[model samples]
Target: GAGVSQSPSNKVTEKGKDVELRCDPISGHTALYWYRQSLGQGLEFLIYFQGNSAPDKSGLPSDRFSAERTGGSVSTLTIQRTQQEDSAVYLCASSLSKPAYNEQFFGPGTRLTVL
Candidate 1:
């Protein structure tokens, strides 16, 4: 089965544009996580989704960032009014259990370049 998949692989946009990144988790996975890795830095948690539970959006950088999971599977992270600071590698991961164990599998990531 597929581990995780993200679209565009790379994106380039001007400041204030909106970008939507997609994530497809492995089948039967109950937990999904989104993260952003900036140049020369560690990954920054964006959000997490577990089953039908309310998503934990605490890690989102600002109101411009939002995400949604449908049918406990695929997810999307939408960045409204994208900024230069939002330029980073957006990674998605999933696990079989909630809270996402260390065994989670990650996507290749979508690299967003905002100029």
Candidate 2:
């Protein structure tokens, strides 16, 4: 019974490098989410995947960001041509459903640093 998990807990790269963050949600969870947390700003919802289909992707900041979920389980967030402004903690969460009464389980997050 593993909870949500993310790989490469910390990543430091140059300004132009591309980074790929991975997330594995808990088994049987159908709702997955990607979020970004900056220094002082609160968590910003990036993309949401429900049962292998993304119903909401409006939160992606720009074209440099994209994500995909396969088999309604694992998800990967890719950032192309990273910038210093993109440095932040990328968090992934999952829940049984998208209902208002459901609670999301958060992962430890992958901290990306652009130097």
The TM-score measured for candidate 2 stands at: 0.96
- Please, what are the lDDT tens digits per residue for candidate 1 over residues 62-98? 9999999998898999999998999999999998884
Candidate 1 runs further than 4 Å off: 100-102
Assess the local accuracy of residue 73 in candidate 1 as a C-alpha lDDT between 0 and 100. Answer: 90
What's the CA error at residue 20 for candidate 2, in Å?
A: 0.3
The alpha-carbon deviation from the true structure for residue 45 of candidate 1, after best TM-score superposition, in angstroms, is 0.5
Model 2, 8-107: lDDT tens per residue? 8999999999899999999998999999999999999998988856458999999999998987789999999999999999999999886466899999
Worst window of 10 by summed lDDT in candidate 2: 47-56
The alpha-carbon lDDT assigned to residue 101 of candidate 2 equals 65
